[model samples]
Target: MTDISTTSRRNFMKLAATAGGGLVLAFSWTNTLASAVMEVLDDTNLASGKIDFNSYLSISPDDVITIFSPNPELGQNIKTSFPMIVAEELDADWTKVKVVQAPLDTNKFERQVTGGSGAVPHSWERLRKAGATARQMLLEAAAKRWKVSADTLTTENGVVVHKASGRKLTYGELATEASKVPVPTDVKLKDTKDFKLIGKAIRNVDNYEMITGKPLYGLDVYRDGMLYAVIQRPKAFGMKLKSVDAAAAKAIPGVVDVVTFKNNVAVVGTSTWQVNKARKALKIDYEAEAPLESSSDHDRIFKELLSSKEATVRRKDGDVEAAFKKAAKVVTAEYQCPFLSHSPMEPMNFFADVRPDGVELIGPIQTPERARADVAKLLNIAPEKVTLELTRLGGGFGRRLYGDYVLEAAELSSIVKKPIKLVWTREDDMTGGTYRPAVRYRFEAALDAKGNMIGYKLRGAGINSGNPTREDNFPSGAVENLLIDSIEHQSPITTGAWRAPITNFLAFAEQAFLDEVAQAAKKDPVQFRLELLDKAKNAPVGAIKYDIDRMKGVINLAAEKAGWGKKEGVSQGFSVYFSHRSYVAQVADVVMKEGKPAVDRIHAAVDCGIVVNLSGAYQQVRGGVIDGLGHAIYSNLTFKDGAAEQSNFNNYRLIRMKEVPEVDVYFVNNGIDPTGLGEPALPPTGGAVANAIYKATGKRLRNQPFINQPELKTV
Candidate 1:
C-alpha cells in the first residue's frame, strides 16, 4: 500500500519550512500536496515561527509528535485511530504524540466528511504515506550528519539508530536539520505485521477531558458579545408561519429581539435561559401549507405503492415472473419500520460571528465544507470568506450531515448584527428535525420442488427513503431470477440518512423473511443462508457485489463462536449483512425468562479488513449492536397530522443499561485495506435479535419496535 509520487514535493517542502526550530511534514489527498499539517512546539516557539504545513504531522524540538486528524470525530474514535495510523508509520513514541482536530481546508484536506463511515477507508493510504515520508526525511537528516548512507539508518520510537556503529540520535536532536531535507516521494509504508500502534488497543485521546466535563462539544462554544437564540418553527411538517406576536416576548427583561426568518421566529437574548423563557412567552400562528399527513396515511400510501405497476426497476436478472410461475411454492411477506429521530446527546447548537469582512463558525458538525459553502451562499459571500472550526461531537448518528442549524446561526447573526449562538431544544430536534424515513418492504421468494430458491423479488415503498432496495446485495446474485424495484411517496416530512441508511431496516426484513422461507422449505436457517452464499461463490446468477469469502468467514465464525444449535434452552438466531464495504455476522442467544424471551448474549464476527484500534473497534461494534437492538425492541417515531407523537426519552424508550446483553466481538483480520466499523455492525443486529425472538416464540414480528407486537411482553 506504498506509493512514490513526486507530485508538488519541492513546493510543499518550501511551504513547510520554518524560520525557527520544528520539523513539519504533510500529505495531501490531492495531486501536488499544498495545504495543512500537524504542529507541535513550545507556545513561544510556535508564536515566533511560521506555523503551516498542509495539515498532517509535525515534530517539535522536545520530541513531541502531533498528528492532525482531518476528519470530524463523533465518538467513532477517529481522533484516536487516525493518529495511531500516522504514529505507527512514523515510528514515533506514542506517549509523546498529541492528536489535534484539523480545521476545514479544502486546499489541504480531502473528504473531510464524517458520514457514510468513509473517513478512515478514504484516508488510510494517504495518512500512512504522510508518516512514512516524515520518518524518511528524519532518517536522511541523521544520515547526512553521520556521513553514512540513508539505507543504514532506522527509526525506533522517535529515535534514529545506526546499529553498526552503535550511534543514535533522537528525532528532537535532528528536528531543525530534517526540515531542510527534500520531501521524499519514494517513501516506504510498513507492512501490517510490522504495525506497533495500529492493531493495539488505544483509549480515546479525549477520554479524560470528556469524563471530567471539560468544554469539548459544540454546546460548550462561547465568544465575547455572543447572543443566545432559540428558534420556534411550525409544529407540523406541512405548516408555515401565519402571524407572529412578539410583543410579550420583547417585554421580557433579558429578551433583546425577536425576528422572523424563513417562516420561523428566533428569540435572541443574552443567556440560554432568557431566550428560552422569552420564546415560550411568544404566541405565533401557523397555516397549513400542504396536507397534514399521518401514520395511517403513510400506511395506505405504502400499500398502494407496493402494488403499483409504476415502479423504478433498480435491478433485474433473468425472468423473475417466469421463474415464479413455474415454482412449486411461493412465500410472500411484508415488513415495516417507522421513522426515527437522531437524538444525539447534545442538541443542535452552533456559534457564528458574521461580520462584513468574513464569517467565523464553530460547532460540532459532520460536514464543515457544506456548512461553510451554505453560509457563504446565504450571506452572498465567497466560500473563502467563511472560517469554520470543528468541535468534538457529542453524537452524530448522521443527523449532523445537514447544515440547517449552521445556516440558522449565520442567518440570525446577520439579522441581529451580533455574534449569535443558536441552540435547539430537545423538542425542536425531535419534532422538527430531518428523520429516518419510514419504509415498507414486500419480499417474495419462489422455490422449486427440490426446495431450492429459483426466483427472488422485492418491492419497497417509503416516505422519502431514496432507493429503498439494495439491488446488488446478498440474495440478488444467489437466485437464478431476481428483480428489485422501489417507489417512494413525496411528503412534507423531511427525511435523511440514518446510521446504515436503507440497510438499517432492510437487513432485518430480508434476513427474517429468508428464515421463514427456510422453514417452508424444511431447512435449517443457518444452513439455508450458507447454501445461498455457496451458490453466489461458485455459480452466481448475476453480478456479485459482495465478497463471498468475507461474508462466509463472518457467518462461519459467528456460528462457531456462539455454538449455534449446541446450547440447550437457548434459541440462537443468526444473521449476516454487507454494508459500508464490510461484512458482519451476529448470533443472538435468547432464553425464556419469566415467560418472556430475553437476549442474554450476542456473538459478532466482523471482516472489516485490518483493524485500526482493537479497543475502539470492539467499542464501536458493541455500541452499534446495542443501538440497533435497543431501537428494534422499543424505539419508534410516529406521526399525527404531520406532527411527531413522541417528544423525548420519557415517551420514546431507549434500552436501559442494565437490560443490555453481553457482546462478544471477533474480527477476521485478512490484511486488506480497512473498511468502516461505525455502521456495518448495526445493520445485521436487528435481524439477529428478531430471529432469536421468533425462535423463542412461535410468532413472527414483521414490524419494528417489537414492543408494539401484542404477543410480545417484557419487564
Candidate 2:
C-alpha cells in the first residue's frame, strides 16, 4: 500500500536563490549552462528525473552556506535537524552552514507548514537529494577547472579535492560555475552508516541566540511606528458585542484609537502596557439570548450522552451480544476528563503591515501558507501579493496551527493603516483558547471462566471534538467481539488539537481500564498488554494500522528497563501507546507523597523509526514525559456561564520544577525512516502516571487533573 503522506512527491529542491549574492543553485530549466551540466550528471539517472530544487540552499560569495528550513520551528529542533539532513548529504562544513526560516511560499517548497511531527519524515529524502545535487554540481565544476575526472576527486569540508593532483578548491571559488550545473532529478544519498551530522547530537541553529536572549522570536520583532493592539473578546461563548463606550479608552494617555470589528473591540496604543491598561477601562456590553451554559450543565449533558444507547458504532467485528452472554464475568468502568487549554509558553501574537498593494506578516505561525492565503482573501488581494515569514515559537504544541491570531493582527493593521502587533494577553489566550475537548469514556469487557478476554465495548462522549482517536486505534483487533461507539455533542466552546490530540485522553482512559482488566484476569498489567499485542500480531481479526510487534517490543523494553515488578518501595505502573506512527511505552514509579501519589521516576522506551538526533530525541521524550505528567497531575480549563473561570497562571496551575521527576529515555534502533517523536511520547506518559497513582492509593480517579479531588493535597 502506498503511503500518501510520504510517496506524494514535490519538487522541493528547485529554484534556489542567493540571499546576498552568487551561486545559490536556482534549478531553472531556462538556464542553458545548468541544463548542460545536469545532462552530464544525469548519467547516473537516480530515483526521479525531475530536477526542481526549491529555494532553500544558498551559498554567499564569502562561502557562507545558508539552508532555509521549510518547516516552522516550534522548539521541536527542526531548525537543527532539517539542516542536518541536507548537510549530511552535501558534506558541507557544519560549522560554516547557517539555517534560516523560509518565507511562506508553497510554490517554492510544497506544504511549508509544520505540524504532526512530520518535518523530518516528510522532507528526509527530498532534502538529502537537494544537498547531494549541489555537492555533485560543485564537484563537477571543480573537475572542469582542475582538469580531473569528477569520480577521481572527492569533496570534504566544503572543498573539492583532486587527491592525485594535490589540488583543492573551496565551494565558494567554484560556486559561480556550479550554479550553472543542472540539478539532478535524483541524487545518490549517503548510507546511514556514513552520516556525520545526522543521527548525532548537533546544537540547534538558534540555541545560542535563544540562550543569550537574542531577538529571534515573534515577540522580539519590532517595526518602527508599529502600534501595539489588544482585542477585547466577547465575555461568554456565543455572545456578541452589544455596545461599547470607548471615550475613556481613547482619552487614555498614548491611546491611539478603538475599532469595533465583527466580534471584538480593539484598543490600539503606543505600547502593549498602555493598550492592556486602556482595554480594562473600555465599557463593553455583550448580549446573549439566554444565560451562558457552564461546565455543570455540560457535565450533565455528557453523562446523558454517555449512557444513551443510541450511538453510531464506528467499528464492529464478531458477535458482541453472544460473547457477553457466554462470558463468566463482566466488568465496566467510566472515565471523564475536563477541557484543557493549549497555554503555550508564548502568548499568541502576530505582526502585520497591510498596504494597498499587499500585506507582510511576520510572526510565529505553524501554517504560514494557509495564513497568508486567508489574509489575502480577507483583504481582497491576490495571495501572491501577501508574504508571511516565520519567527521562533516559544512553544506550539498544536496551538499555532490556527491563523486567527495572524488574521487578527492583519485585520487590525489594515484598519489602522499602519504596522501593528496584536498581542493576546495570557488572560485572553486562556479564556479564548482553542482547548482540548472535555471527554467521557465508558468501557466494558467480558472474561470467560478461564479469565481470557472475550468481548469489548467502548462508548465515548465529547463536545465539539471529533473522533481524533480512530476506532481501530489499538486493542480493537485484539478482542474477538469488539465494537467502538462515540457520541459527539455540539458546543459553542472553541477546541483544537492538543499535544497528542484524541490519544491524549484515550490512552489514559483505555490503558487504565485495561489494567483493571488485568487485575481481574490475574495477570501483570505489562504482561497482559503484551499478551493481547502478541495475539494481534499473530492473528489480527481486522485491518490493524499499528504494528503489534513494535507495540509489544516497547512495552517489554520499558518493563525490563524499569525492573517492572522488582521495584521494592515504589508502586510501578506501565502503559504503551502508538500515535503519529510511533510507538512509546512508559513505566511510571510513584510513591505516596503526603496523602497523594507523587511521581519518583519515569522510564520510557520509544520506537520512533530511527532517532534523528539522540540528544534531541531524548529531550523530546523527557519533555513529553514531564509535560504529560504535569497535565495529568494538575491541569483543567473550567467554565462558568460559558465564561472561563481560570483566567491566568494564578488559577491555571502548571507543574513546577520541584515537582519534576527523574526521567530515563530509551529508543528502539530499528533502521526505518524517521517517524514522529514529539507527540507519540506524550500520550503514554499520562496513562503510566494515572495507573501509577491508582497503584499507590488503590483509588481509581476517573477524572483528569488529579487535583480535581481535594484529597490529592496534604494541606
Task: Say which candidate scores most in lDDT.
Answer: 1
lDDT of 1 by residue, 1-715 (tens): 1211112323333333334476866556553232223343333534454544446577777788876666889999889988888889989999988877777778767778899888788878877877888888899899999999999988899899999999999988898888778776467789888998888999999999889887778888877678999999999999999998899999998899999999899999989999999999989999999999999998899989999999999999999999999999999999999999999999999989899989888888999999999999999999998888888898989999999999999999999999998999999999998899999999999999989999999998889998998999998899999999999999999999999998999999999999999988899998999999999888888799998889989999999999999999999888999999999999999999888899999999999999999999999999999999999988999899989999998897889999999999999979999998999999899889889988999778899899898758532
What TM-score against the true fold does each predicted structure earn?
A: 0.95, 0.92
How much is the lDDT of residue 142 in candidate 1?
96
Q: Determine which window of 10 residues in candidate 2 has minimal summed lDDT.
A: 1-10
What does candidate 2's lDDT look like per residue over 270-375, in tens digits? 9999999999999988898555879999889888998788778899989999999999989899888888888888999998999987788888988888899899
The runs of at least 3 residues in candidate 2 whose Cα sits more than 4 Å from the true structure, single-residue gaps closed, are 1-22, 26-53, 162-167, 180-182, 593-595, 710-715
lDDT (Cα atoms) of all candidates against the true structure = 0.87, 0.81
Cα displacement (angstroms), candidate 2, residue 300, comes to 0.5
Error of 2 at 165 (Å): 5.3
The parts of candidate 1 lying over 4 Å away from their true place are 1-20, 31-53, 713-715
Query: Evaluated with TM-score, which candidate comes out highest?
Result: 1
